[model samples]
Target: MPEVFTAYVRIVDGFNRRVGRIVMYGIFVLMGILLYSSMSKTMFLPAHWTLEMAQFVMAGYYLLGGAYSLQLDSHVRMDLLYGRWSPKTKAVVDVVTILMLFVYLFFLLYGGVSSTAYALQYSETSYSSWSPYMAPVKIVMVIGIALMFLQATSILIKDIAVAIGRPLP
Candidate 1:
């Protein structure tokens, strides 16, 4: 059973790592394309399109990078106090923080789903001339929030196991 659980964890971790890298790289590529388009637009099309593309790229970058940031533990934190704690204490703090994040992200996911549904129903699009499909971008928020939530849950589970002395497989 422990071996099976270990395998599961490894599989999940590997999958998240791969997905994170893909999303991060995808954002970079998208940004590059947007940059080139904007540069070309300065001479060809309207300048407004460049702003729209920039906005889309920025939103996409943040959403897609969220899970990767969490996975890498690169997100900002107030370590001034947390850094002083012992391993066990740190584990406890981590568990608590994960719980809080889980709750917050769950709410975000709920809201995102609702918003996506509304957008879908209304056939939402940007009010600007560039008017790309807003539904897709909105949907990405749900995916990003859900992924972050899952990562938080996974960390919380591992931290709880450690706190109880069994530890994670």
Candidate 2:
């Protein structure tokens, strides 16, 4: 509808797309970690970090890619009534219902930021034997959640545009 909103959508969409593309390769990293874990278990003593590292990578992969998934409309939905709706109807529905998503994302982001702050302040570590520092992953979580929030806002703007018959490119 406005140049500012159009710019925001473009920038957020482009950045998230790049991030998602890069993060997609994380699956290979996870596989490599698992492969090494298996080999080490058979050939030598199992490493303490492999399991936990894999978990971290998986979390980063999904959480970081969340905005991209939303942009692509790849996130799961009920689709019961949505699939039958006309484009303009869908945009109107999305404009209204997206408020709930914003609320949810706001709470999630708040909690993530608070937890990340605590982790950074206390130099928190996992309870696992390896006990890796928790701040890095917590920071990643906060960043990912923030990106999702931005993407959700962009979606709302686009939906508004569509509802008003000024659909963005």
Candidate 3:
């Protein structure tokens, strides 16, 4: 069972890393597009799609990178007290906190899927001057929530092993 959990963690972590790198590049592209749009507005023609497109890229960046950030333990955490705990104590704390994380992710996944479905069903748009379809980003959000939830599970397994003095694979 420990080996199986380890394999699962490896796969989830790998997926997060892959998605995170892609999103990192996507953010860079969004930056470049925004920059070009800014310069063009002062010099020649303003690109209307630049803002909308950048938003799309940013949404992807945020959604796809969430699991990766969690995997790296990079989320905002109050470390003053937590940093001083022993490994087993930290694992116990993690297991307790993860329940709340799981609950939040559960709601996000539920809401995101409903929103994405509605958007796709009605061909929803932003109603902005440079409006774009909303379904794609909503779908990405759902995917990201699922990824984060999976990563949380993976971490929980490791924490359990640590707390129990089991050698993690």
Clashes of each: 0, 0, 0
Across 1-169, the per-residue lDDT of candidate 2 in tens digits comes to 8799999999999999999999999999999999999999999999999999999999999999999999999998899999999999999999888899999999999999999999999999999999999999989898899999999999999999999899999
Question: On a 0 to 1 TM-score scale, where does candidate 3 land against the true structure?
Answer: 0.94
Candidate 1, residue 159: Cα displacement in angstroms equals 1.2
Arranged by lDDT, best first: 2, 3, 1
Which tens-of-lDDT digit does each residue in 1-169 have in candidate 1? 2665556556656666777887776766666767778677777754556667667766767776777687788999888888888767888889887877877887888899999999999999889987777898888788778777766666666676677677765
Tell me the lDDT of model 1 at 14: 66
Which residue runs of candidate 3 sit more than 4 Å off their true CA positions?
A: none
Provide the overall lDDT of each model, using Cα atoms, as 2-decimal numbers.
0.75, 0.94, 0.87
Which 10 residues in a row give candidate 1 its minimum summed lDDT? 1-10
lDDT of 3: 0.87
Model 1, global lDDT: 0.75
- Look at candidate 1 and give me any clashing residue pairs: none
Candidate 2 whole-model C-alpha lDDT, 0 to 1:
0.94
Q: Which pairs of residues collide in model 3?
A: none
**The candidate that achieves the highest lDDT relative to the unseen native structure:** 2
Q: Which stretches of candidate 2 lie over 4 Å from their true place?
A: none
TM-score of each: 0.85, 0.98, 0.94
